[model samples]
Target: YAMTAAHKTLPLGTYVRVHNLENNRSLVVRINDRGPFVRGRIIDLSYTGAKDIGIVGPGTARVEVVALGRRDTSAAGSATTYIQDDYYSGNFTFQVGAFLDRENAERQKRELAKKYKNAHITVYDRGDKIFYRVRVGRFTTLEEAVQQEEILIQDGFPDAILVAE
Candidate 1:
């Protein structure tokens, strides 16, 4: 995996440099998903990332993790204590709008994606069928999402609301 994988401790959107300690290879990845959930894995890398570090075939390797800088608005504490206290916070994102018609949802998503790097649509079962939700950006803290919600409101997506992802 080239993009960074999940770490139980690192907050989402954290910029980190993962080093393949045994081979001395390194690559930077943005933490976007939660995982490795398996014990002993510190960070997961996307296929491209693992390939870059020469670990694709092996599927896993020892890596030295170094935070480039946490994009996480909340960095609780040292690596150890941080993981413990970290449960206090949750990952959040702003939903600018949702539409029953996939076309409308896709239109909004395309429009927003053109203007915002993190803009995308999430489809979920709202009732008997599915609904498309146009969401933009991820934040480690609810406050950040709220702030973005206000901006989206000002930008005319008045329905924007903060939601946990």
Candidate 2:
């Protein structure tokens, strides 16, 4: 299937324009999966899209990507953003809450599910303990995240901190 590739960080359904710098070929693809988790890799091209860009044989090529926008298609699908193209502090997000307990993290995630887009819990190890962080929304520009962070703080997420993801 030559639909599209996965994005580890960007929200699914995001519109991304991938430009093959070598061939000067470009394609706009909608993200519908997750991947390219390996370091130094950004997006994984599908066989169809790969064929279009003439890179199926070479397997990999240097490319530049530009995020066009995103449309939420979750079960509660109603949120969207036309995120302007900004290069400053790319992919900044806000961590509204963090808990040492997974249950507490899940609880927050549920509460946010009703009110925010891309609300989810990301588990990670810090020092000797595991922390579950409840994050909300992925923004390309830091200013956008900061605006939401302030709203979250006013709404009682006092610990909301902006993170460059």
Candidate 3:
């Protein structure tokens, strides 16, 4: 069975379980699409399923996933969200940019702040390498991120990629 946490139409053959490492609770789920692409996130459960597994806030989690067989429509407890195709409808605002140097990232952040309203640089140290990420806006969906990337690309920031925050 396929397991995923993103928004896509699911076929009739996927099963997943979210096992919380902290609490040792598990919730069986169906695979509807491909997601939970956020760094360090194992699975993305629906709101109800997340509650059942006891994850409340918005952040990464340590969880184990066990793939079962195909999904049975006649199953007892299945979680579903009626998210329409246009569910990500919103004004695009956020743009995330990756940089190899801290000084260059800071310079870009200052420049963007002069043009736009909100621009910030987040620095992350991965082993001996440091990554500086410049993000704009408080977007709600990947579509919004893609829209903002278009705008940034027009402004000469071509290598930006969308990331969930």
Q: Rate the local accuracy (lDDT) of all candidates.
A: 0.72, 0.77, 0.61
Off by over 4 Å in 3: 1-96
Sorted on TM-score, best first, the list reads 2, 1, 3
lDDT of 2 by residue, 63-100 (tens): 99888875444435455545543446688776777799
Off by over 4 Å in 1: 1-88
Can you write out model 1's per-residue Cα lDDT over 16-86, one digit (the tens) per residue? 78889889999877777755655456677888888888998888888898766554446666552122224
lDDT, candidate 3, 32-136, per-residue tens: 643444544545676777777677674546788765546445646666422223325433344456689888888888888887666887777779888887877
RMSD of 2: 11.3
Error of 3 at 107 (Å): 0.8
Query: What is the C-alpha local distance difference test score of candidate 3?
Result: 0.61
Which stretch of 10 consecutive residues in model 1 shows the poorest summed lDDT?
A: 80-89
lDDT score of residue 145 within candidate 1: 66
Give candidate 2's whole-model lDDT.
Answer: 0.77
